[model samples]
Target: MSSAPVVVVATFTAKPESVDTVRDACKTAIEAVHQEPGCDLYALHEADGTFVFVEQWADQDALKVHGTAPAVGALFGAIGDHLAAPPDIKFLQRVVAGDPAKGQLRA
Candidate 1:
């Protein structure tokens, strides 16, 4: 674990027909994830009709655990075929936030 927070940006594009289902599914999943331990923030956003997850964790290790959780794994597995394309996910570290700060990302 580190002092800086871990951020995750994930995007999921839905097939036109699966948009509604995808939205509903992600909403349910995101809400559940919000209650997870070490989760600082787990929010969903819509980006050009794609579902975007903007998340913050207490640290990298926490994020790793959450990523592999049964809940998360199931959601992804269940929705894989419904997605318009493969999910786009990126792990990030804050550079300048909350009044001026800088940090680095580590694997």
Candidate 2:
């Protein structure tokens, strides 16, 4: 497994009637995820009915552990029914481009 730091982008679309419930559940999950080891970032963004999460982990091992974290289970249990479908999660590798200070997710 790769030991490099990783970034994750996860998107969840909430059913029209369940936006608030999804948002609240995600908020609670973010709080708990922030406390996880190797979690450099775990932020939530909402627009229309879509919720986006931008997260950074120290390494692949940490990301793997986070997949089964209790916070993740609780989040799924709380908002599974409210979601339009399964969350879309993508793991990304950053490529250097513009300014080093602003081009990537930094701690």
Candidate 3:
């Protein structure tokens, strides 16, 4: 099987009173994406009202599909009114597969 090619790390700070709503929306998005064909992992974490989304996809194409999915679109739309600032997103290429100390780097 091919390894996941793209990993996305996203950070969002929710408005104090809207934290629960934001988290619920993010959770729904994660659940939706996790059911898609090329999604490897979809996780959401929260700390002090800040939500972090981490996802692993088969490739760029899969990531693109996730980005355009209705659930994701709706989540983004809903979060806009509850976010402290725009979400921060970063894409990474996996260089290691197992233990950090033992895994080989891609380059």
Candidate 4:
């Protein structure tokens, strides 16, 4: 797998009646996120009843900027009232893929 300084994987379960609303709410922010300087990937997927977002950033600073972006706030405001529960989010590091394990980081 390729390397990224920051990778985010998030999951959100929309209250059955709120899926469309959630998806629509995320459009603006996702569009703007794709235009950000260090955003290598910002893809959303739907499976079962959950929405998932996978993101890659050039570095930590870039990720931090995304946290404060205007579109981000707008997105939350639009969807905040409809989420089934709070979004499940995490920052990850790729350590293994397929059949191999890569070297570990010491820091």
Candidate 5:
């Protein structure tokens, strides 16, 4: 089996009044994560006050660096009061790629 770091996906629902604030905070966090040495991808998406974070790292160490970054800390500090609930985070390993119409296996 090929060895690769797992992907992290997170979804956050923000209070209506705090949507913009959350989006800004997430953007800052993404930027910080993107600059990390082993970060593959760090992106944030928003829709109707819902925010999603999609991150890919080279390994656990890289993810740890992101978790402790000052920008992430700042974002957490700023958005804590604005969230309706804690963010939902998921870790996944790719099982398929290429085309959705055709099944593929990871190995």
Candidate 6:
């Protein structure tokens, strides 16, 4: 696989009553993801009732592996019904510009 780093943003909207449940599941998965090979960043954020995950990986191969990791499976199983809809996942490509450090995600 290519060695280019991968960036992903996944958004999940929780049902009003299932907010805590979804958050808990995501936190559990984040802990496991942090220990995975090639994981650079796996952070969670929330606003209103929407949860967002911003992730960075070493390369395409690593990202592919992460997609099928046990943590991912557990995360889905735990929060599947709690989500308002299917996750909104986006894979991104960086465009280099001035101030390289400020322009792109570290790691």
Q: Which number leads on TM-score? A: 6
Number of backbone clashes in candidate 2: 0
Question: Which residue pairs come into collision in candidate 1?
Answer: none
lDDT of 3: 0.82
Say which candidate scores most in lDDT: 6
> lDDT of each model, Cα atoms only?
0.80, 0.94, 0.82, 0.80, 0.79, 0.95
User: Which segments of model 4 are wrong by more than 4 Å?
Assistant: 1-4, 97-107
Higher-lDDT candidate of 2 and 4: 2
Candidate 3 stretches greater than 4 Å from native: 1-4, 95-107
Instruction: Name the weakest run of 10 consecutive residues (lDDT summed) in model 6.
Output: 98-107
Error of 2 at 35 (Å): 0.7
Per-residue lDDT over 1-31 for candidate 6, one digit per residue giving the tens place of the 0 to 100 score = 8898899999999999999999999999998
Q: lDDT value for candidate 5? A: 0.79
Show model 5 residue runs off by greater than 4 Å: 1-3, 97-107
lDDT of 3 at 47: 98
* TM-score (all chains, Cα) for each model: 0.84, 0.95, 0.83, 0.83, 0.82, 0.97
The true-structure Cα RMSD of candidate 4 reads: 5.2
For model 4, residues 1-63, the per-residue Cα lDDT tens digits are 233468889888888888888888776678898888788888889976688888888788888
Backbone clash pairs in model 5 (N, Cα, C under 3 Å; residues 3+ apart or in different chains), count: 0
Model 2 agreement with the true structure over 20-55: per-residue lDDT tens digits: 999999999988899999999999999999999999
Q: Flag clash pairs in model 6.
A: none
Residue 6's lDDT in candidate 1? 84
- Given candidate 5, what's the lDDT at residue 55? 77
